[model samples]
Target: MDILQELRYRGLIHQLTDEEGLTKKLSEEPVVLYAGFDPTADSLHIGHLLPILCLKRFQMAGHLPVALVGGGTGLIGDPSGRSTERSLNTSDVVEEWTDKLRGQLSQFLDFESTVNPARMANNYSWLGELNVITFLRDIGKNFSVNYMLAKDSVDSRLSNGISFTEFSYMILQAYDFFRMNSDINCSLQVGGSDQWGNITAGLELIGKSTGNKAFGLTMPLVIKSDGTKFGKTAGGAVWLDAEKTSPYQFYQFWINTDDNDVVTFLKYFTFLTREQIAELEEQVKLSPEKREAQRVLARVMTELVHGEDAALSAIKISEVLFSGNVETLSGREIEEAFKDVPSTELSGNEEIGLVDLLIAVKAAPSKRQARQDIESGAVSLNGIKVSDVEKVLQSSDRMEGRYIVIRRGKRNYYLAKFV
Candidate 1:
């Protein structure tokens, strides 16, 4: 498929300026495109995946992708789509976050390739050196307060009050785009729909200063069928970082997608062709009993983010845990499978007793609750139902000599480490 057609088929194209013109322009030679990521948090959540994925797509099509890290802009948080004034993060905090964000982004874009390899740039490099006077005289003159206020970022904040720091964010982002456009010959910027105003400002800067044109494209914010935000589950933001959000939890998050929302998500997130997605949708509609679509969504994302091995292990752990067939699973598999789930690594301490293990892991609310669960056949240790009121802790029972996977019925695996 052509670039435009593939983007359309994968449901990656949101809003692009002059699609045909841009497509025609891109067809001739390799071009440069950019997407900026704000280090607002320590980890990049699924919300950050769209732009990163777009960068991958662009690079795959023989274009260079500049993944811009917002070390500078992050200090003055972008007010776009925010309901209230943001609590500005400390410079040190943001810098720390920026480094981690760069690492997470590295997992998405191919930076080691000899051809069209992705490049990482930080806006802080240029933005830090600019004097206030030069900034105002050079780039700031092009954007008026009236014009900035007219934009949506400033519009929604007219009542809540927009700070000068926040107001200047557009200029900073524009400068980043300008720097990329000038230094790297990067002419395309991609972001979420909310970034239209800031992205347009960058285009205006290019037109005014260099008399060049740039393009902006965005992907729709992932949202649920109920109009609620996506990438959130009972445990919280479905982070790509396993430490923040476990693989088991992440897999379950996708597997539990509402019947109505799975198809839309498959279109938005997965690289499946139109026919493949259509088939999944058809299965959901015709055979609602079989959840083929949700399963595919879970597997595709799991494999993309984690890897085939991780996804398989997560699936195995999930099947064993959910299927209530613990006998088939080894102790090592239990720990590997529940790595992302809530776990407490115990040391090989012969002094630690089973009662302390259950309470320490919070599998039981109290000693009495622990006794109750053990007696009710609901508690099992290493796949064996344990009813011994005074089961002694043994170094040998410790799976892998330091841990044991305890389960409460068909689900909820808790790990206890003997220290």
Candidate 2:
């Protein structure tokens, strides 16, 4: 199937300009396509996954994928989806973020491909050197004030405020396309639905400045069935950086996908065949309790973003936690599993009674309650029921020589770390 048809089947195509022209261009030759990522944060979150994966999809289909890092335009934020203007970051901060973005992007594309290696470009290479005169006369002249104000990005911001710096972002982005076309022979730009205006502006500039045909495509913004935004949890945005969001948490984010949304996400994110997705859809309908679809989604997404080892670890952690088999976890796995669970630190590895340890970790309300819970078999130490109020916990009870897991009832868990 053609790349466009594949994306259409996956529900990835949101807005496309000159579909026939782009279809012909892609079919005729290995058309070079580019997508830009602004360094707004040091890490790209799950929200950025669609476009990054889109670039990979094109590359796998024998097209040259150019990942553009917007070090230049990031200095002046794009007013596409925001109601308020962005606070400008220092040049040092933007440069630092740009480097991080570049590194994260590199992991997604096969730059070492002998057939068609991916290319990485930064707009700062050209935009930083542009002078006010050249920017205004050469690029800014192409855009009319009336036409600019009519854009959704500008019109939405006009009520409260919109700075010239951000208003002129469309021109800078258009120049990026013009430059990419002139230098790298890039013919297409892809971005999120909110970037429709800027993308079309780039196409217009390329048409007028170079008198060449260029194409723009946008992907739909992800939304959850619950009507809340996707990629956001109670903690915050699910970051692609493992350090910011651990592999386990990232895996859990997909594992807990709403029943109404899982099948669609499988189609959108994974490279699963239509037949495979249809099978999963059938599973969803027949046995929603099995959650096979959610599990597959979590595994595929975790492996794609964090690598096989991390994904395996995440799966192991999830399984252990689900089965309440805390004792089976390794030291590192225990830490990853209980990272967010309520925890207390022990100053030293001291032998203490189970009830005393429970009191120390606040797993129980008090020593009296701890003893009562222990006697009632309502408390467990490291996945083993502790019924003896006098049962003592020794150093041998510690998993990994440092950590112990305590449970109050079936659900409440506490982590005790010995120094």
Candidate 3:
């Protein structure tokens, strides 16, 4: 299938400007397209993946992709999707975050491809040097106050009192598209659905300035069927940085996808073909209990972000915990597996009685209850039934000599960490 067909098949097209024109442009040559990612935080999260992957899709189809890091605009936050104003960051902080985003983006695009190698650009290089007179006269002259005010990004914020800094964000972004079109012959710009106004502004600027025909495409913002925001866990946003959200946690996030949303997410997030996704959709219809679709989504997404080894390890940890075989997990895996579980820290590696250990970890309310639970085989330590009330937990009982996995009943889990 063609690139457009593939994207259409995946339901990725949200808004496309001059589609017929773009189709002709794409067919004649490998059109250069660009997407901008502003570094609002130290790391990119799952929210950024759709466009990142879109850029990858374009690249794979023999087009050149430019991943633009909005170092310039990061300093001036876009008001497109915000009800409130953004706190401006210092140049040093924005630069630091910009570098981090640049590196993260590098992971997705193939810069080494001999035919159509991906390119990276930081808008700060140009925007920083742009003089006020040049910006106002040369670029800003093309936009009318009425036209700018009419944009959804600006209109929505009028009630909330949008700041001038943010109001001018559209122009800055337009300048970016114009700059890319001028320098690199970039004809297409893609972003989330919220960016339509800003994107069209860029197209307008390009048309007025260089008389060049530029295109804009936006992907639908990912949201769950339950009406909650996507890419969010109870902890916070699911970050691309493993340090922020571990591979296991990332895997679990997708693994827990609602049955109603899995197939759509599979279409949105993965490169899995229509037939493969169709098969998974059928599996979901036949055996929702198996969660085969969710597992595949988690595995593919985790491997894409974290790597094959981490994905496999996360899968193993999930399986081990699900099957009540916690003894097989390594210390790291155990920590990841029980990251959100209640934990008690032991000061040192001291041999403690099973009842006392259970009480200390709060797995049991008291010695009497602890013993009752242990004797009833309702408590297990490290995946083994510890029915002996007199059993003592020593260094031998610890997994990796540092931690013990305590399970009380079928579902409750606690972690005992020996400091």
Q: Estimate each model's TM-score.
A: 0.89, 0.97, 0.97
| lDDT, model 1, position 304 | 86
lDDT of 3 by residue, 1-419 (tens): 38888899898999999889888888889989999999899999999999999999999999999999999999999998889999999999999999999999998999999999999999998999998899899989999999999998899999979988999999999999999999999999999999999999999999988888999999998889999999887899999998899999999999999999999999999999889999999999999999999999999999999999999999999899889998899888988888899999996748899999999999998999999999899998889888999987788778898888899999999999999
Q: By TM-score, how accurate is candidate 3?
A: 0.97
Specify the poorest-scoring 10-residue window by lDDT in model 2: 347-356
Report the candidate with higher lDDT, 2 versus 3. Answer: 3
What local distance difference test score does each model get?
A: 0.84, 0.92, 0.93
| Per-residue accuracy of model 1 over 54-76 as CA lDDT, tens digit each | 88888888889989999989888
Query: Per-prediction RMSD in angstroms?
Result: 2.9, 1.3, 1.3
Across residues 187-208, which tens digit of lDDT does each residue of candidate 2 receive?
9999999999999999889988
Residue 12 of model 1: what lDDT? 75
CA shift of 244, model 2, Å? 1.1
Error of 1 at 4 (Å): 1.9
Question: Worst ten-residue run, lDDT, model 1?
Answer: 345-354
In model 2, what are the clashing residue pairs, if there are any?
none
